[model samples]
Target: MRVEYDDVETEDDLRVTYQGDLFTGEVVERSPQGQVIAITTYFNGMEDGLSTEFYPSGERKAEGSARYGTAVGVHQEWHRNGNLAARLEFDDQGKLLSRHRWAEDGTPIESFVAES
Candidate 1:
């Protein structure tokens, strides 16, 4: 993957710019203990597909789909103990369409629709 960035020199001559790849692939980040913390997909420097996060113990913490850098479609999150914590839906414009939350014991606690 080729990463492209623009350089802007600061007053002290320090350079900085936005960074990312211009291709599609999985980007893995590991914790200090060498455990996978997150796995994300990218397309044209934007998050365009499935992405996931993991708990320290390797359990899935969240899973979701994105398009053009915005969260879209069904996304799920879970508690550290593995119980579902929430489910959310978003429109193509990245606006949340609805959301539902659950308790640690797997009981539904709240649900609501997003105002357009």
Candidate 2:
């Protein structure tokens, strides 16, 4: 179910709730001006799917996946100008596996992999 962020309350480690019950589905957060700022997916009260955040101008700023509140797979962040800023990968258990970063001008900044 789609819910406005302001209409929901956060409880116990940031679990989303609506009308005092754990929420499952999508929560949409909007800027004061009524622009969508973020969209998050939840399951059984925990983050469990793709979540995305946007810049004030409606450009995608970041996106990632999660399972039961633990980050998984690849997460990406972008500069407000829309250039890729960072990319991070995580193991199934949410351990950081690797990370790559770049400057807003598209210059490579850092790249790392876990010692495994």
Candidate 3:
């Protein structure tokens, strides 16, 4: 994946720099503090492959995959403390298939399945 930097505006009042494109490469976003906050991949200008995000403290917050700009497959989330948060599964059409949640302490919370 190509890596470059460009200034970008954000609603959180922090300047971000985007590295890479939404096609055949991975885009990495860096916070104004120079911390890598997110990394997403793209295929032919659409979101594809693995996507990941991290807390400002460098802890992973979320991880998932996208297919042609839509969320698909199994996705996972976590708390900044490295605790399990949620897990979701989706179909190729971006339809939710199943979902499960857990507390930061690893306590099971709830689970659900998609209709149809």
Model number with the top lDDT = 2
Q: Model 2, 51: alpha-carbon shift in Å?
A: 0.3
Instruction: Assess candidate 1 and give its TM-score to the true structure.
Output: 0.76
Give per-residue CA lDDT, model 3, range 37-85, as digits (tens).
Answer: 8987766666678999999899999999998778999999998789989
Clashing pairs in 3: none
Error of 2 at 72 (Å): 0.2
For candidate 2, list the clashing residue pairs, or say none. Answer: none
Report the error of model 2 at residue 43, Å.
0.8
**For candidate 2, what is the total of clashing residue pairs?**
0
The lDDT of each candidate is: 0.74, 0.94, 0.77
**Clash count, candidate 1:** 0
- Which portions of model 1 miss their true places by more than 4 Å? 1-23
Please name the candidate that would achieve the greatest TM-score relative to the true structure. Answer: 2
lDDT of 1 by residue, 31-81 (tens): 778788787776655677898999878999999998867899999999998
**Runs in model 2 with CA error above 4 Å?**
none
lDDT of model number 1: 0.74
